[model samples]
Target: NKIVLPVASSGIAALLLPGGRTAHSRFNIPIDLKATSTCHITPGTMLAELIEKAALIIWDEAPMTHMHAFEALDKSLRDILSLHDPKAKTLPFGGKTVLLGGDFRQILPVIPQGTRAEIVSASISHSYLWESCHKFTLQKNMRLSEDEKEFSNYVLRVGDGNPLPTEVNEFDEDEEDQLISIDRTLVEELSSDPHKQILEATYGRTDQWKGTK
Candidate 1:
């Protein structure tokens, strides 16, 4: 039977999708991948068989995974599918349709103690597969309520590295070290009884939530 596989770079994102799993867990990807690495999936194994039958794969948080991870999957898929068709070895993802979803502005792959250049190099956009991939942009913020549009736009502007009108006077565009001040209205001040205020905000008033279990 044909199946759709849903995977994500992070556990939280995987849990948000139906029948989803972490890409590393599902693909048996190595923790330390190299340029010539392939996934540890053995041919004729249950996972390999499932991959052979997969109709499509949906990977969320794609930008958060290392380029090496994607390349590893590509090499493994090509090898696995080549068993059926010799030409599959040259095709991407073994010719199985893959839908990758993520905002590059949100987060890139993490490399411990890696410089900015290393982090950018580790992103999937730097991989060879990126050349063949089609790109789509989502222009609207569908999840935000009507009242949140301004805040959402502000957040987006920050992510896009655009200086806000309020910040133009205080920050120099050319300065390597720049800081944007948060609006006081958005901050919750806990000047008095900080612990109690935190508890009340998190779990509601003691009387309302006490001994409910």
Candidate 2:
């Protein structure tokens, strides 16, 4: 909240992003593009300055981000800060330190691409930002009971260093099969029945719809 919202006060380009909050309210995060969006295309926005001036972009829940998140941010940087070229379409936060809190051994990012959360940026890791990444484990059990911690630790031990284990899956496999499931009722009311199925078909897969699905 401090990092994201505070940047807004700086009057730089800001996007609250979709999801995370009331679906009807302002939590519908559009998309994150920090990785690829570079500073060669255009000048950063007024709000972008706050982020530029600030010492850090403390992303509290970074593990929950998607794979293309940085890519989207890259475009944002191009939109806010500088651009790669007058016509290029990419952006980068320009060395802005992303203070990623939260435990890597904890939950992962919100990936719409269906890629395993661990696969978000397999080549580059959180600590690899510069030199080496840092790891900090809470010394005491602040959120879990001793028993629960013991179980979680057991699971972590089972996997060893294979990959970060996943917490709750958010939705079951059945629900997943449904988000992409056709909205027959909406289609029936909005358009002719024959075209309804067709329209639904069209929405299942598109670059823009990629995140929604």
Candidate 3:
């Protein structure tokens, strides 16, 4: 079996990797890449022993991290692996396979008080290594039930800035400043015994919740 290092931009990586999750900043091969005024990576004083040990690296929720971080890591990795093999310096990720998985529709790079341009610039797509990235598509909504498949597709469309159906009544343009309109009946139902409703909804049955008790 190949020794693989599993790292994440967030905790979501824990659910996907058996080795658990390591924070992106801490995912180092016995060396640190210090951030500087320039985007170029400056390698720290150290032996990259982990580079020789690990066969692959799996990074989850990658889009949530800044592009500069990835670029720095890429440069650092190449520097480290070059010490082991000269040709590795030219390889993507230092000739070590790296799997980076993240849904663009999910969480984005957090740019506090930053403009739209800053937000876009922070994404991994804007990184120097993005051009070499091989794209993969995950079509299935594994979290949703068969009955909620349509709802899952609709939610994805909405996330992509597409308009919701008229019946959904998400917003009222006629009202002051396009106020969100919550259906009265739905509100009443939700407000009453909200916890119990949530439990039932979560497990998909009242009996399922009762059994856990």
Candidate 4:
């Protein structure tokens, strides 16, 4: 049977797929990475054998992973696949097919206390391997129902930093930063004990949940 490896940048995303794993865990990627880092996989090991046999890899939440991780995997794959095919040494990920899924407008690679430039630089889009990747976009939100279409579109606009017309008057015409206005219906006013109010709103009143669990 053809092996299809499904991995994600986060544990929660990994669980959504069949037999999925976190990319870092599966590849043994270094926590402290450099520009020229390779995965911890040793040649001729079971993991290496599995990589050699894998027909495709599906990586979800890929935009959230540091570029060095992908580079490290690429280096390791080339090293392992070169044992059987010398030409594989020059190919990206040893010529294995890789499908990455994520939205750039959503959460990107987190660089602790990093500036916008540093974070952008750490994204896979900035990696050398990105040149070889083919891009695709899903134009429709199939998961949302017709009633939720407007809300989904609004969310997308917010994620893209596009301010609604109602908020345009609040900012200067020459303003570089985007200012989005949240719909009043979506906002909930909290009391003095904000945390307790939030908890009650989410799980119901304390009396309602007391001894239930």
The best candidate by lDDT is 4
Q: What global local distance difference test value does model 2 have?
A: 0.42
Candidate 3 lDDT over 1-213, as tens digits, reads 877777888666665678757545445422232343222334443325654567888888888877766766676677777886899789877888888988888878888899879888779898768888999998888999998876776667756756343443554556433333333433445557788778766666676545564
TM-scores of all predicted structures: 0.87, 0.40, 0.72, 0.88
- TM-score-better candidate, 2 vs 3: 3
Name the regions of candidate 4 deviating beyond 4 angstroms. Answer: 165-178, 191-197, 200-211
- Candidate 4 per-residue lDDT, tens place, 1-213, comes to 899999999999999999999999999999999988899999889999998899999999999999999999999999999999999999999999999999998899899999999999999999999999988988898889999888888889888777465544656866636456786757899699998888887888877766777
lDDT of the candidates, in the order given: 0.89, 0.42, 0.68, 0.90
Question: Residue-wise lDDT of candidate 2 within 10-79, one digit each (tens)?
Answer: 1111244321222112212244334443332224545555544556554444554443443444445445
RMSD of each: 2.7, 15.5, 5.3, 2.6
Per-residue lDDT over 83-194 for candidate 1, one digit per residue giving the tens place of the 0 to 100 score? 9989999899888889999998888988999998999999999999998799999988989999988888778877787735445554576753356556565678865888
What is the descending TM-score order? 4, 1, 3, 2
* TM-score head-to-head 1 vs 2, winner: 1
Q: Which stretches of candidate 3 lie over 4 Å from their true place?
A: 28-47, 165-213
Count of clashes, each model? 0, 47, 0, 0
As a whole number from 0 to 100, the lDDT of residue 137 in candidate 4 is 86
TM-score of 3: 0.72
